[model samples]
Target: MSHYAARNAQGHHRVHKNDPEAIAHLKREHHKFRKLVDRINAAKTPGAKRDIAVELHKLLASHIALEEELFYPAVKSRGLADEVKEGLVEHDIQRFLSAQIEAMDIADPLYGTRLGVLGEMLVHHIDEEDDEMFQEAKKLKLDLDAMNERLETREHQLKAQYARTGRIRTPALDREVRARNAV
Candidate 1:
Protein backbone atom coordinates (compact mmCIF):
# COMPACT_ATOMS: atom_id res chain seq x y z
CA MET A 1 0.00 0.00 0.00
CA SER A 2 1.04 3.58 -0.58
CA HIS A 3 2.14 5.73 2.34
CA TYR A 4 -1.05 7.69 2.05
CA ALA A 5 -3.16 4.57 1.99
CA ALA A 6 -1.47 3.24 5.08
CA ARG A 7 -1.86 6.57 6.80
CA ASN A 8 -5.53 6.65 5.84
CA ALA A 9 -5.99 3.23 7.38
CA GLN A 10 -4.77 4.80 10.63
CA GLY A 11 -7.52 7.46 10.41
CA HIS A 12 -5.37 10.20 8.88
CA HIS A 13 -7.94 10.76 6.22
CA ARG A 14 -7.11 14.46 5.87
CA VAL A 15 -3.67 13.65 4.54
CA HIS A 16 -3.74 13.79 0.79
CA LYS A 17 -2.34 10.97 -1.32
CA ASN A 18 0.04 13.55 -2.75
CA ASP A 19 2.06 16.08 -0.74
CA PRO A 20 -0.38 17.83 1.52
CA GLU A 21 2.28 19.39 3.71
CA ALA A 22 4.13 20.86 0.75
CA ILE A 23 0.90 22.19 -0.71
CA ALA A 24 -0.02 23.76 2.59
CA HIS A 25 3.38 25.36 2.88
CA LEU A 26 3.08 26.81 -0.62
CA LYS A 27 -0.41 28.09 0.13
CA ARG A 28 0.81 29.81 3.29
CA GLU A 29 3.61 31.46 1.40
CA HIS A 30 1.17 32.64 -1.23
CA HIS A 31 -1.00 34.19 1.44
CA LYS A 32 2.00 35.89 2.97
CA PHE A 33 3.06 37.23 -0.41
CA ARG A 34 -0.35 38.75 -1.03
CA LYS A 35 -0.34 40.33 2.41
CA LEU A 36 3.11 41.76 1.83
CA VAL A 37 2.00 43.27 -1.46
CA ASP A 38 -1.01 44.77 0.18
CA ARG A 39 1.22 46.30 2.83
CA ILE A 40 3.47 47.73 0.14
CA ASN A 41 0.54 49.25 -1.69
CA ALA A 42 -0.73 50.88 1.51
CA ALA A 43 2.57 52.37 2.59
CA LYS A 44 2.54 56.17 2.84
CA THR A 45 6.25 56.85 3.16
CA PRO A 46 9.08 56.16 0.75
CA GLY A 47 11.10 54.36 3.41
CA ALA A 48 8.12 52.16 4.30
CA LYS A 49 7.54 51.33 0.69
CA ARG A 50 11.17 50.45 0.10
CA ASP A 51 11.30 48.23 3.17
CA ILE A 52 8.16 46.40 2.22
CA ALA A 53 9.37 45.98 -1.34
CA VAL A 54 12.59 44.43 -0.10
CA GLU A 55 10.62 42.00 2.10
CA LEU A 56 8.35 41.11 -0.83
CA HIS A 57 11.35 40.52 -3.07
CA LYS A 58 12.98 38.21 -0.53
CA LEU A 59 9.81 36.22 -0.01
CA LEU A 60 9.20 35.91 -3.73
CA ALA A 61 12.77 34.89 -4.48
CA SER A 62 12.70 32.18 -1.84
CA HIS A 63 9.25 30.96 -2.83
CA ILE A 64 10.22 30.72 -6.47
CA ALA A 65 13.38 28.85 -5.61
CA LEU A 66 11.45 26.37 -3.49
CA GLU A 67 8.98 25.66 -6.27
CA GLU A 68 11.48 25.54 -9.12
CA GLU A 69 14.12 23.47 -7.42
CA LEU A 70 11.97 20.91 -5.61
CA PHE A 71 8.22 21.05 -6.12
CA TYR A 72 8.16 21.69 -9.86
CA PRO A 73 10.76 19.05 -10.60
CA ALA A 74 8.78 16.49 -8.61
CA VAL A 75 5.65 17.42 -10.54
CA LYS A 76 7.48 17.21 -13.85
CA SER A 77 8.81 13.79 -12.93
CA ARG A 78 5.21 12.76 -12.46
CA GLY A 79 4.57 13.78 -16.11
CA LEU A 80 3.51 17.40 -15.65
CA ALA A 81 6.19 18.80 -17.91
CA ASP A 82 4.00 21.42 -19.55
CA GLU A 83 2.92 22.90 -16.24
CA VAL A 84 6.47 23.03 -14.97
CA LYS A 85 7.66 24.78 -18.14
CA GLU A 86 4.88 27.32 -17.96
CA GLY A 87 5.66 27.95 -14.29
CA LEU A 88 9.32 28.54 -15.05
CA VAL A 89 8.43 31.05 -17.74
CA GLU A 90 6.22 32.88 -15.29
CA HIS A 91 9.01 32.85 -12.72
CA ASP A 92 11.35 34.35 -15.28
CA ILE A 93 8.95 37.18 -15.94
CA GLN A 94 8.57 37.71 -12.20
CA ARG A 95 12.32 37.71 -11.67
CA PHE A 96 12.81 40.25 -14.45
CA LEU A 97 10.17 42.52 -12.98
CA SER A 98 11.61 42.03 -9.49
CA ALA A 99 15.03 43.13 -10.67
CA GLN A 100 13.54 46.18 -12.31
CA ILE A 101 11.57 46.99 -9.18
CA GLU A 102 14.65 46.56 -6.99
CA ALA A 103 16.52 49.11 -9.08
CA MET A 104 13.82 51.73 -8.77
CA ASP A 105 13.64 54.45 -6.14
CA ILE A 106 10.46 54.38 -4.09
CA ALA A 107 9.89 58.01 -5.01
CA ASP A 108 9.89 57.27 -8.71
CA PRO A 109 6.47 57.70 -10.34
CA LEU A 110 6.70 54.39 -12.10
CA TYR A 111 7.48 52.48 -8.95
CA GLY A 112 3.87 52.12 -7.89
CA THR A 113 2.77 51.18 -11.37
CA ARG A 114 5.44 48.52 -11.63
CA LEU A 115 4.56 47.12 -8.24
CA GLY A 116 0.89 46.98 -9.21
CA VAL A 117 1.73 45.07 -12.35
CA LEU A 118 3.85 42.61 -10.41
CA GLY A 119 1.07 42.07 -7.90
CA GLU A 120 -1.41 41.33 -10.67
CA MET A 121 0.95 38.92 -12.35
CA LEU A 122 1.67 37.13 -9.10
CA VAL A 123 -2.03 36.79 -8.27
CA HIS A 124 -2.75 35.24 -11.64
CA HIS A 125 0.24 32.93 -11.38
CA ILE A 126 -0.68 31.79 -7.89
CA ASP A 127 -4.26 31.12 -8.90
CA GLU A 128 -3.18 28.95 -11.82
CA GLU A 129 -0.66 26.98 -9.80
CA ASP A 130 -3.05 26.38 -6.93
CA ASP A 131 -5.98 25.49 -9.14
CA GLU A 132 -4.28 23.53 -11.88
CA MET A 133 -0.73 22.44 -11.10
CA PHE A 134 -1.41 21.54 -7.48
CA GLN A 135 -4.56 19.72 -8.45
CA GLU A 136 -2.65 17.72 -11.03
CA ALA A 137 0.08 16.96 -8.51
CA LYS A 138 -2.51 15.64 -6.07
CA LYS A 139 -3.93 13.31 -8.68
CA LEU A 140 -0.41 12.01 -9.38
CA LYS A 141 -0.01 11.00 -5.71
CA LEU A 142 3.30 12.70 -4.94
CA ASP A 143 5.09 12.06 -1.63
CA LEU A 144 4.33 15.53 -0.31
CA ASP A 145 5.59 15.02 3.25
CA ALA A 146 9.08 14.21 2.04
CA MET A 147 8.92 17.04 -0.46
CA ASN A 148 7.78 19.42 2.25
CA GLU A 149 10.70 18.51 4.47
CA ARG A 150 13.09 19.00 1.57
CA LEU A 151 11.52 22.36 0.77
CA GLU A 152 11.84 23.46 4.40
CA THR A 153 15.48 22.50 4.50
CA ARG A 154 16.16 24.24 1.22
CA GLU A 155 14.38 27.39 2.35
CA HIS A 156 16.51 27.54 5.48
CA GLN A 157 19.68 27.03 3.48
CA LEU A 158 18.66 29.76 1.06
CA LYS A 159 17.85 32.10 3.92
CA ALA A 160 21.24 31.49 5.50
CA GLN A 161 22.95 32.04 2.17
CA TYR A 162 21.05 35.28 1.71
CA ALA A 163 22.02 36.45 5.19
CA ARG A 164 25.66 35.74 4.43
CA THR A 165 25.63 37.40 0.99
CA GLY A 166 23.06 40.17 1.53
CA ARG A 167 21.26 39.07 -1.64
CA ILE A 168 18.33 36.83 -2.47
CA ARG A 169 19.90 34.27 -4.76
CA THR A 170 18.42 31.57 -6.95
CA PRO A 171 20.61 29.89 -9.59
CA ALA A 172 18.38 30.48 -12.61
CA LEU A 173 17.46 33.99 -11.54
CA ASP A 174 21.07 34.89 -10.78
CA ARG A 175 22.10 33.78 -14.25
CA GLU A 176 19.28 35.73 -15.85
CA VAL A 177 20.19 38.85 -13.89
CA ARG A 178 23.83 38.48 -14.84
CA ALA A 179 22.91 38.16 -18.50
CA ARG A 180 20.70 41.22 -18.27
CA ASN A 181 23.48 43.15 -16.57
CA ALA A 182 25.98 42.02 -19.20
CA VAL A 183 23.88 43.64 -21.89
Candidate 2:
Protein backbone atom coordinates (compact mmCIF):
# COMPACT_ATOMS: atom_id res chain seq x y z
CA MET A 1 0.00 0.00 0.00
CA SER A 2 1.05 3.60 -0.50
CA HIS A 3 2.38 5.44 2.56
CA TYR A 4 -0.61 7.76 2.39
CA ALA A 5 -2.96 4.80 2.06
CA ALA A 6 -1.33 3.38 5.14
CA ARG A 7 -1.84 6.69 6.90
CA ASN A 8 -5.49 6.61 5.99
CA ALA A 9 -5.70 3.27 7.79
CA GLN A 10 -3.88 4.40 10.94
CA GLY A 11 -6.58 6.59 12.42
CA HIS A 12 -10.22 6.62 13.32
CA HIS A 13 -12.76 7.45 10.65
CA ARG A 14 -12.74 11.12 9.67
CA VAL A 15 -13.12 13.62 6.84
CA HIS A 16 -9.49 14.42 6.07
CA LYS A 17 -6.46 12.18 5.46
CA ASN A 18 -3.38 14.37 5.90
CA ASP A 19 -1.83 16.02 8.93
CA PRO A 20 -2.85 19.56 9.78
CA GLU A 21 0.30 19.84 11.84
CA ALA A 22 2.38 19.19 8.77
CA ILE A 23 0.41 21.77 6.86
CA ALA A 24 0.92 24.28 9.61
CA HIS A 25 4.65 23.60 9.58
CA LEU A 26 4.77 24.09 5.85
CA LYS A 27 2.85 27.36 6.16
CA ARG A 28 5.42 28.65 8.61
CA GLU A 29 8.23 27.76 6.22
CA HIS A 30 6.45 29.57 3.43
CA HIS A 31 6.26 32.64 5.60
CA LYS A 32 9.93 32.32 6.36
CA PHE A 33 10.66 32.35 2.66
CA ARG A 34 8.61 35.51 2.31
CA LYS A 35 10.53 37.10 5.13
CA LEU A 36 13.79 35.98 3.57
CA VAL A 37 12.79 37.71 0.39
CA ASP A 38 12.06 40.83 2.38
CA ARG A 39 15.42 40.62 4.05
CA ILE A 40 17.19 40.10 0.76
CA ASN A 41 15.48 43.19 -0.60
CA ALA A 42 15.80 45.38 2.48
CA ALA A 43 19.43 44.86 3.39
CA LYS A 44 21.78 47.76 2.66
CA THR A 45 24.97 45.70 2.76
CA PRO A 46 25.79 43.48 -0.20
CA GLY A 47 27.43 40.90 2.03
CA ALA A 48 24.40 40.64 4.28
CA LYS A 49 21.99 40.37 1.37
CA ARG A 50 24.14 37.70 -0.23
CA ASP A 51 24.29 35.70 2.95
CA ILE A 52 20.53 35.97 3.34
CA ALA A 53 20.01 34.89 -0.26
CA VAL A 54 22.17 31.82 0.23
CA GLU A 55 20.16 30.80 3.25
CA LEU A 56 16.95 31.54 1.37
CA HIS A 57 18.08 29.28 -1.46
CA LYS A 58 18.67 26.43 0.94
CA LEU A 59 15.30 26.98 2.62
CA LEU A 60 13.45 27.03 -0.70
CA ALA A 61 15.24 23.89 -1.84
CA SER A 62 14.36 21.96 1.28
CA HIS A 63 10.77 23.23 1.24
CA ILE A 64 10.33 22.14 -2.35
CA ALA A 65 11.86 18.80 -1.55
CA LEU A 66 9.33 18.23 1.24
CA GLU A 67 6.33 19.14 -0.87
CA GLU A 68 7.47 17.04 -3.79
CA GLU A 69 7.94 14.08 -1.54
CA LEU A 70 5.11 14.25 0.97
CA PHE A 71 2.39 16.71 0.07
CA TYR A 72 1.93 16.53 -3.70
CA PRO A 73 1.67 12.77 -3.90
CA ALA A 74 -1.04 12.68 -1.27
CA VAL A 75 -3.09 15.22 -3.19
CA LYS A 76 -2.51 13.42 -6.47
CA SER A 77 -3.65 10.14 -4.99
CA ARG A 78 -6.88 11.88 -4.07
CA GLY A 79 -7.46 12.57 -7.81
CA LEU A 80 -6.10 16.02 -8.50
CA ALA A 81 -4.78 15.03 -11.93
CA ASP A 82 -4.21 18.38 -13.61
CA GLU A 83 -3.05 20.05 -10.46
CA VAL A 84 -0.54 17.31 -9.83
CA LYS A 85 0.98 17.56 -13.28
CA GLU A 86 1.12 21.33 -13.27
CA GLY A 87 2.47 21.34 -9.76
CA LEU A 88 5.40 19.13 -10.72
CA VAL A 89 6.10 21.39 -13.64
CA GLU A 90 5.95 24.34 -11.32
CA HIS A 91 8.48 22.65 -9.08
CA ASP A 92 10.82 22.29 -12.01
CA ILE A 93 10.46 25.98 -12.71
CA GLN A 94 11.18 26.86 -9.11
CA ARG A 95 14.19 24.59 -9.03
CA PHE A 96 15.54 26.40 -12.03
CA LEU A 97 15.06 29.76 -10.37
CA SER A 98 16.66 28.50 -7.19
CA ALA A 99 19.71 27.38 -9.10
CA GLN A 100 19.98 30.76 -10.78
CA ILE A 101 19.73 32.57 -7.48
CA GLU A 102 22.34 30.28 -6.00
CA ALA A 103 24.86 31.07 -8.71
CA MET A 104 24.36 34.81 -9.06
CA ASP A 105 26.45 37.19 -7.00
CA ILE A 106 24.32 39.27 -4.65
CA ALA A 107 26.69 42.22 -5.03
CA ASP A 108 25.88 42.48 -8.71
CA PRO A 109 23.67 45.37 -9.79
CA LEU A 110 21.04 42.98 -11.16
CA TYR A 111 20.65 41.03 -7.93
CA GLY A 112 17.50 42.75 -6.72
CA THR A 113 15.76 42.35 -10.08
CA ARG A 114 16.63 38.68 -10.18
CA LEU A 115 15.55 38.12 -6.62
CA GLY A 116 12.32 40.02 -7.24
CA VAL A 117 11.45 37.78 -10.16
CA LEU A 118 12.14 34.67 -8.12
CA GLY A 119 10.05 36.05 -5.26
CA GLU A 120 7.18 36.70 -7.63
CA MET A 121 7.41 33.16 -8.95
CA LEU A 122 7.41 31.80 -5.41
CA VAL A 123 4.41 33.92 -4.39
CA HIS A 124 2.38 32.69 -7.33
CA HIS A 125 3.46 29.11 -6.76
CA ILE A 126 2.56 29.23 -3.08
CA ASP A 127 -0.87 30.66 -3.90
CA GLU A 128 -1.60 27.79 -6.31
CA GLU A 129 -0.46 25.12 -3.87
CA ASP A 130 -2.45 26.53 -0.97
CA ASP A 131 -5.51 27.34 -3.04
CA GLU A 132 -5.73 24.41 -5.41
CA MET A 133 -3.63 21.51 -4.11
CA PHE A 134 -4.21 22.00 -0.39
CA GLN A 135 -7.86 22.85 -0.93
CA GLU A 136 -8.24 19.62 -2.85
CA ALA A 137 -6.64 17.70 0.00
CA LYS A 138 -9.18 19.27 2.39
CA LYS A 139 -11.96 18.09 0.14
CA LEU A 140 -10.83 14.46 0.50
CA LYS A 141 -13.03 12.53 2.89
CA LEU A 142 -10.41 10.32 4.51
CA ASP A 143 -9.51 10.03 8.17
CA LEU A 144 -7.65 13.28 8.69
CA ASP A 145 -6.20 12.46 12.06
CA ALA A 146 -4.64 9.28 10.80
CA MET A 147 -3.26 11.07 7.80
CA ASN A 148 -1.76 13.76 9.97
CA GLU A 149 -0.05 11.18 12.10
CA ARG A 150 1.38 9.56 9.03
CA LEU A 151 2.55 12.93 7.79
CA GLU A 152 4.25 13.62 11.06
CA THR A 153 5.87 10.24 10.89
CA ARG A 154 7.05 10.79 7.34
CA GLU A 155 8.28 14.30 8.04
CA HIS A 156 10.19 13.05 11.04
CA GLN A 157 11.89 10.49 8.88
CA LEU A 158 12.83 13.12 6.33
CA LYS A 159 14.07 15.53 8.95
CA ALA A 160 16.14 12.91 10.66
CA GLN A 161 17.74 11.98 7.39
CA TYR A 162 18.39 15.65 6.61
CA ALA A 163 19.99 16.18 9.98
CA ARG A 164 22.34 13.34 9.39
CA THR A 165 23.32 14.29 5.85
CA GLY A 166 22.79 18.05 5.70
CA ARG A 167 20.99 17.54 2.39
CA ILE A 168 17.96 15.77 1.01
CA ARG A 169 17.88 12.22 -0.26
CA THR A 170 16.71 13.47 -3.60
CA PRO A 171 17.20 10.49 -5.88
CA ALA A 172 15.16 8.15 -3.75
CA LEU A 173 12.25 10.54 -3.35
CA ASP A 174 12.40 11.73 -6.94
CA ARG A 175 12.05 8.17 -8.12
CA GLU A 176 9.32 7.47 -5.61
CA VAL A 177 7.12 10.46 -6.43
CA ARG A 178 7.52 10.23 -10.18
CA ALA A 179 7.16 6.47 -10.25
CA ARG A 180 4.07 6.63 -8.11
CA ASN A 181 2.42 9.04 -10.52
CA ALA A 182 3.84 7.30 -13.56
CA VAL A 183 2.15 4.11 -12.54
Candidate 3:
Protein backbone atom coordinates (compact mmCIF):
# COMPACT_ATOMS: atom_id res chain seq x y z
CA MET A 1 0.00 0.00 0.00
CA SER A 2 1.02 3.63 -0.49
CA HIS A 3 2.46 5.22 2.62
CA TYR A 4 -0.48 7.59 2.87
CA ALA A 5 -3.02 4.88 2.26
CA ALA A 6 -1.41 2.69 4.89
CA ARG A 7 -1.43 5.58 7.36
CA ASN A 8 -5.10 6.22 6.67
CA ALA A 9 -5.90 2.63 7.35
CA GLN A 10 -4.10 2.86 10.68
CA GLY A 11 -5.70 6.17 11.65
CA HIS A 12 -3.99 9.10 13.36
CA HIS A 13 -2.92 8.98 16.94
CA ARG A 14 -4.46 11.61 19.17
CA VAL A 15 -2.59 14.86 19.34
CA HIS A 16 -2.19 16.57 22.66
CA LYS A 17 -5.18 18.74 23.46
CA ASN A 18 -3.00 21.67 24.46
CA ASP A 19 -1.12 21.70 21.19
CA PRO A 20 -1.95 24.41 18.71
CA GLU A 21 -4.33 23.11 16.05
CA ALA A 22 -2.45 24.81 13.21
CA ILE A 23 0.84 23.37 14.33
CA ALA A 24 -0.74 19.95 14.63
CA HIS A 25 -1.97 20.21 11.08
CA LEU A 26 1.46 21.23 9.80
CA LYS A 27 3.17 18.50 11.82
CA ARG A 28 1.10 15.96 9.94
CA GLU A 29 2.39 17.28 6.62
CA HIS A 30 5.92 17.19 7.93
CA HIS A 31 5.40 13.55 8.81
CA LYS A 32 4.29 12.83 5.26
CA PHE A 33 7.38 14.60 3.93
CA ARG A 34 9.60 12.22 5.83
CA LYS A 35 7.58 9.25 4.60
CA LEU A 36 8.10 10.29 0.99
CA VAL A 37 11.82 10.49 1.62
CA ASP A 38 11.64 6.93 2.90
CA ARG A 39 9.75 5.93 -0.22
CA ILE A 40 12.60 7.34 -2.31
CA ASN A 41 15.07 5.26 -0.39
CA ALA A 42 12.99 2.10 -0.72
CA ALA A 43 12.19 2.46 -4.42
CA LYS A 44 14.00 -0.35 -6.23
CA THR A 45 13.56 0.98 -9.75
CA PRO A 46 14.03 4.31 -11.46
CA GLY A 47 10.42 4.39 -12.64
CA ALA A 48 9.07 3.96 -9.14
CA LYS A 49 11.41 6.60 -7.77
CA ARG A 50 10.40 8.97 -10.55
CA ASP A 51 6.75 8.63 -9.68
CA ILE A 52 7.44 9.21 -5.97
CA ALA A 53 9.58 12.23 -6.81
CA VAL A 54 6.77 13.85 -8.76
CA GLU A 55 4.29 13.22 -5.97
CA LEU A 56 6.70 14.68 -3.44
CA HIS A 57 7.20 17.79 -5.59
CA LYS A 58 3.49 18.47 -5.87
CA LEU A 59 2.96 18.06 -2.15
CA LEU A 60 6.01 20.14 -1.23
CA ALA A 61 4.94 22.96 -3.51
CA SER A 62 1.52 23.13 -1.92
CA HIS A 63 2.93 22.80 1.58
CA ILE A 64 5.36 25.62 0.91
CA ALA A 65 2.47 27.76 -0.32
CA LEU A 66 0.68 27.17 2.97
CA GLU A 67 3.67 28.35 4.98
CA GLU A 68 4.52 31.30 2.73
CA GLU A 69 0.94 32.47 2.31
CA LEU A 70 -0.36 32.11 5.81
CA PHE A 71 1.72 30.45 8.51
CA TYR A 72 4.98 32.41 8.38
CA PRO A 73 3.31 35.74 7.81
CA ALA A 74 1.15 35.18 10.81
CA VAL A 75 4.15 34.31 12.96
CA LYS A 76 6.20 37.18 11.59
CA SER A 77 3.43 39.57 12.49
CA ARG A 78 3.84 38.44 16.07
CA GLY A 79 7.50 39.59 16.08
CA LEU A 80 9.27 36.42 14.98
CA ALA A 81 10.51 38.24 11.89
CA ASP A 82 13.97 36.67 11.83
CA GLU A 83 12.62 33.15 12.18
CA VAL A 84 10.16 33.71 9.38
CA LYS A 85 12.89 35.06 7.13
CA GLU A 86 15.10 32.05 7.83
CA GLY A 87 12.22 29.69 7.07
CA LEU A 88 11.61 31.43 3.75
CA VAL A 89 15.25 31.11 2.77
CA GLU A 90 15.21 27.39 3.58
CA HIS A 91 12.12 27.05 1.43
CA ASP A 92 13.87 28.80 -1.46
CA ILE A 93 16.72 26.28 -1.23
CA GLN A 94 14.23 23.43 -1.29
CA ARG A 95 12.54 24.91 -4.34
CA PHE A 96 15.80 25.28 -6.21
CA LEU A 97 16.85 21.71 -5.46
CA SER A 98 13.42 20.38 -6.38
CA ALA A 99 13.54 22.14 -9.76
CA GLN A 100 16.89 20.56 -10.54
CA ILE A 101 15.70 17.14 -9.42
CA GLU A 102 12.65 17.38 -11.65
CA ALA A 103 14.80 18.24 -14.67
CA MET A 104 17.00 15.17 -14.25
CA ASP A 105 16.09 11.62 -15.22
CA ILE A 106 16.34 8.98 -12.52
CA ALA A 107 18.77 7.19 -14.82
CA ASP A 108 21.29 10.02 -14.58
CA PRO A 109 24.43 9.28 -12.58
CA LEU A 110 23.87 12.21 -10.25
CA TYR A 111 20.15 11.60 -9.81
CA GLY A 112 20.38 9.57 -6.64
CA THR A 113 22.99 11.86 -5.14
CA ARG A 114 20.92 14.96 -5.75
CA LEU A 115 17.75 13.35 -4.47
CA GLY A 116 19.61 12.14 -1.39
CA VAL A 117 20.94 15.63 -0.78
CA LEU A 118 17.45 17.06 -1.08
CA GLY A 119 16.14 14.43 1.28
CA GLU A 120 18.79 15.29 3.85
CA MET A 121 17.99 18.96 3.49
CA LEU A 122 14.30 18.29 3.96
CA VAL A 123 14.93 16.27 7.12
CA HIS A 124 17.05 19.06 8.54
CA HIS A 125 14.49 21.68 7.54
CA ILE A 126 11.63 19.75 9.05
CA ASP A 127 13.49 19.30 12.32
CA GLU A 128 14.29 22.99 12.66
CA GLU A 129 10.78 24.04 11.77
CA ASP A 130 9.22 21.62 14.18
CA ASP A 131 11.64 22.02 17.08
CA GLU A 132 12.12 25.78 16.81
CA MET A 133 9.61 27.73 14.76
CA PHE A 134 6.57 25.65 15.56
CA GLN A 135 7.33 25.66 19.26
CA GLU A 136 7.59 29.44 19.12
CA ALA A 137 4.39 29.77 17.17
CA LYS A 138 2.55 27.74 19.74
CA LYS A 139 3.61 30.25 22.36
CA LEU A 140 2.74 33.25 20.16
CA LYS A 141 -0.94 32.81 20.98
CA LEU A 142 -2.32 33.01 17.44
CA ASP A 143 -5.81 31.72 16.81
CA LEU A 144 -4.89 28.08 16.36
CA ASP A 145 -8.25 26.61 15.38
CA ALA A 146 -8.93 29.42 12.91
CA MET A 147 -5.50 29.01 11.38
CA ASN A 148 -6.05 25.28 11.00
CA GLU A 149 -9.40 25.89 9.32
CA ARG A 150 -7.81 28.23 6.78
CA LEU A 151 -4.98 25.79 6.20
CA GLU A 152 -7.50 23.05 5.56
CA THR A 153 -9.28 25.22 3.02
CA ARG A 154 -6.02 26.14 1.34
CA GLU A 155 -5.01 22.50 1.13
CA HIS A 156 -8.29 21.63 -0.57
CA GLN A 157 -7.92 24.49 -3.04
CA LEU A 158 -4.32 23.65 -3.81
CA LYS A 159 -5.13 19.98 -4.33
CA ALA A 160 -7.94 20.93 -6.66
CA GLN A 161 -5.64 23.23 -8.63
CA TYR A 162 -3.06 20.46 -8.96
CA ALA A 163 -5.73 18.01 -10.03
CA ARG A 164 -6.76 20.38 -12.80
CA THR A 165 -3.31 21.52 -13.99
CA GLY A 166 -0.81 19.14 -12.39
CA ARG A 167 0.82 22.16 -10.72
CA ILE A 168 0.28 24.61 -7.91
CA ARG A 169 1.08 28.25 -7.25
CA THR A 170 -0.32 30.94 -5.00
CA PRO A 171 -0.80 34.67 -5.44
CA ALA A 172 0.98 35.24 -2.16
CA LEU A 173 4.09 33.50 -3.44
CA ASP A 174 3.80 35.19 -6.85
CA ARG A 175 3.86 38.61 -5.24
CA GLU A 176 6.84 37.67 -3.12
CA VAL A 177 8.74 36.46 -6.16
CA ARG A 178 7.93 39.60 -8.08
CA ALA A 179 9.10 41.83 -5.26
CA ARG A 180 12.40 39.99 -5.00
CA ASN A 181 12.94 40.15 -8.75
CA ALA A 182 12.25 43.89 -8.85
CA VAL A 183 15.24 44.63 -6.67
Order of candidate numbers by lDDT, starting with the best: 3, 1, 2
Model with the higher lDDT, candidate 2 or 3 = 3
lDDT of 1 by residue, 17-105 (tens): 44488987887677676667677777777678778888888889999989978898899999999998888888888988998999998
TM-score of each: 0.81, 0.71, 0.86
Model 2, runs deviating above 4 Å:
1-19, 143-166, 173-183
What's model 1's lDDT at 3? 18
Superposed Cα deviation of residue 135, candidate 1 (Å) = 1.2
Off by over 4 Å in 1: 1-19, 172-183
**Model 2 lDDT-worst window of ten:** 1-10
Clashing residue pairs, candidate 2?
Answer: 16-144, 19-148
- lDDT of all the models against the reference? 0.78, 0.65, 0.80
Off by over 4 Å in 3: 1-15, 181-183
Q: Which candidate tops TM-score?
A: 3
